[model samples]
Target: MSNIPFTLHTQNSAAINVSLLYAASSKYEGEWSGTPHSHPYAEFFYVLRGEIDFQAEGEPYSLHEDDLIVINPDVNHTERPRGPGTVEYVSFGVEGLCMDPADSGMWSSCSLFHCRQSRSEVRFFLRLLLAEFENNLPNYEQLCCHAFESLLVFLKRAHPQELAVTAPKRTARECSAVKRYIDANFRQPISLDHLAEVSQLNKYYLAHAFREYIGLSPINYLNSRRVEEARVLLRDTSHSISEIAGIVGFSSQSYFAQVFQKAVGESPGEYRKRLRRGRQEKQE
Candidate 1:
């Protein structure tokens, strides 16, 4: 048991300010040693390396690699390494930020216990947070804050324990599978019927469940995904508009341009030129 007081990283302090109390990373070897403590600030932790045996307000929980846990303000909690292997993680605290209890609005609702069951979603968020922590770019703190809020919302939908009404017992699980599929196949033409068949649910039920839990219908979500891919292509690749459009599942460049403008508020070519100019100005 090592009595290491959590070390705070100060690099982000200027941007985060005092309202965001602290952010730190730690690795534990062999045991649980820290005092069972509670803080006035809300705390969020992401396990990056190994498993941790966590005890929060007398409830036992285990967090594996890529797992996330949130301890709301003043929740008594303690954690120890699950084994001899090292447990590495990052944590941050938020002050003067609290959620309303009755909101129960998916993950946005205030709750003492929130956990992420999806490894991919947890990993995605951890990488995003690590990027912000490592690179203190302008507005990185705000990016991290938004990412944290998104994480809470994701956990609310991904974690069964936080759900208010009973969804069919496997609602979250099936939704996770469906989401992963969409993420993987977003660039391809994916149909709602196919998505429903893949998830083993009726189309109408799948639509309702997906929107209720993931906040997007299959087709609308797919188009949004295609637009996101298009933005990446526009900024990072030299592929022609038609080529990029086809690659991202859009049937025609004209159609893609219209959708991109609708979503991004500018034509793809215009957006790309703006980004290039912004980069050039930065270099100047």
Candidate 2:
């Protein structure tokens, strides 16, 4: 699956940020609904009335009243009204959430919930959330945070599916092995499939676990290592830019320049020139 290369491996998730963004009760139009969109934050759709077809992770699901659907970060999805029917959905998005280790594993693993049972309890929490946002009473921020956390607690307790499947952590030995492999062989054409095979992991598990620990896709991490190697070549060796690009596994000089600038905030030639100029000034 295609995904953005944004990740953070944080030990203290309590420092992670979370917010209740844009809680509104409205009827969406029946025409074309909205274009497929993805965000870096998590979002949920709670349908109080009416039915709509929702798509997540490229799969279509029919949602009805009391259904809670979560769309995970960076997952592309869209909604379409069912046969000119309007959907009354109360939705909110959150970012940088923290949970217990097991909960975090479950949270990272699952996104869509076909239905969260207990309509009245879920409805009550939804109303409470909307009220908290609207009232803005004193200490409302703490109140809202508690209310949101309670709502998730209710969902998790009510639905075992959320806890059913979790990603297994790669042993430190295996993680170190993968890191060493990347460091030693970033110049080779290393694909996710190849890494998955070497690490004895499925593609999805490998991608998720690797990012959970390393904070980057294996390919991006490999690119970073390649860029660091290229920097050394540019500084200490007499290789041409094209030759350096080849040595670094970059297909073309232009692509190498682009990745180098993105990683180091400067072009290869500019970086080399600045370093040489600094050395000369030191000699003077």
Candidate 3:
């Protein structure tokens, strides 16, 4: 046998960095349609079971199991179950990456990688990533992030030219706007969907980013704001608990009392009475 020497050299610089915004699994049954919305970062969907009818920019495509779709940024799309059966899929919001499916004339702004022929790796990575989230063990964030990067690497290997790395822009301005809106409208009915529409962000991503920056989820922050106002009313004004609850935008006094008790140490009435007792003792 002849001896042969082979050495491979590669650059040490880093490439293909992606930030996982959010990853989730969903199962839909019967007739359900999502509102058409667009985001600033690329979104991905992998059909695990059943069929999904996806509409992007008014173009409809029937996606079956093992079908992978990568939607570029700012492309309005919606999905629903194709038929009577249930449609289950895993979705990911990825920042710092974009897809250019120029070779496929049929898919204009998005690329569809048909994984029917070879789907084992895709299935494995997604299943493992979701399990990490479901289990939420120690250092699950790091594990999930690595799993996400592995899945992205697989996509890049499958279609080298279609995927490219781009850093995700910071969303400080948008997050600030959401905070301002919540501060102004805390006395009115608010929901996550409304917040998503206001910020033009996917709700999941918005919630994640808001929590990271503000230390609380959007709805939680809103409730905190309401509770803050309720405390002021409880201390300064002699309004009834029910009246104060209505003034702070709570639908029912019981819910307001429950939330107030959770945030503070005691119920609203108890808090007010304690304050009154302290004030009377000071006067005496």
Candidate 4:
């Protein structure tokens, strides 16, 4: 019998502090039910079966089996079944980690990678981490976290040009500050010029950097915030549509309706009516 030898080496490295917040596996049949939304943490997805289409930051991409994607914080994205087959995938919500590419042509917020050659290895880590989370035995959380960090190491090695995990740049920090400001004062008459004054960054650079870091231009982000608040008010309050529009910082109801439809796929009145109808049906 031939003998094989293996050696292990150790090197100094800084600790990457990341917490695996959650993991989920989903299978969607025909008539997928997904909404455009975003979160403030990094998310990872691996397609296990079939094809799916992902719209991230207004760009469309079709992904097949053995493919993975990483989305940065505050990036708007949605996914649905592609073609005619069922879609199955596993996703992980991670915090305290961000990814940027060494080259151009790939948005740091939405990075897609095809992994046909490393399918088995990729699936192994994903499935293992998922199983550990599902099992929830002793030290399962620790195990899952370790597995996820190891998976990141593997991915960086495999996609060196694409997965250069690094700290947030200065611009990203400034953009984040602006995002927080918007969150607090979206109902005000905020503009790019005002934001520039607040952040002390140029208007053009602030717009571009905000989009690069947050996945939407400043105005777009403001509009999205207004839409989100409008949705809540429509569902909960009996306020008139126009009043809601003005309260959410829109100049006119017509413009509010236009932006709301583009973001939510329905007019505000229609959404409110549908919600009320559902509530009435439940009560009846």
Give the runs in model 2 whose Cα sits over 4 Å from its true position.
Answer: 1-17, 98-110, 114-116, 164-284
TM-score of each: 0.48, 0.50, 0.49, 0.59
For each candidate, the alpha-carbon lDDT, in order, equals 0.67, 0.68, 0.76, 0.78
lDDT of 4 by residue, 161-230 (tens): 6656644344755676687688789999998999999999999999988887667899999999999999
Error of 4 at 192 (Å): 4.3
Q: What's model 4's TM-score? A: 0.59
**What's the CA error at residue 144 for candidate 1, in Å?**
34
TM-score of 3: 0.49
lDDT of 3 by residue, 3-93 (tens): 1112211122335455566678988778786787767667889999998888865568889999999876666788888779888899877
Could you arrange the candidates by lDDT from highest to lowest?
4, 3, 2, 1
Clashing pairs in 3: none
Can you tell me which runs of candidate 3 are displaced by over 4 Å? 1-17, 102-108, 167-284
Backbone clash total, candidate 1:
0
lDDT measured at residue 283 in model 3 versus the true structure, 0 to 100: 100
Which parts of model 1 are misplaced by more than 4 Å? 1-170
RMSD of 3: 19.5
lDDT of 1 by residue, 1-284 (tens): 11112222222232222254556788777776767786665677778788888876556787877766666555567888876888899887766443322324331212333244566675676577667766778877676766665665675566444433211123644665676577778887788899989988999998988776556787777888899989999899999888999999987889889989988999999999999999999999
lDDT of 2 by residue, 15-106 (tens): 33355555667776565646877666567788877887887544578887777777655556787767776668888766543222244432
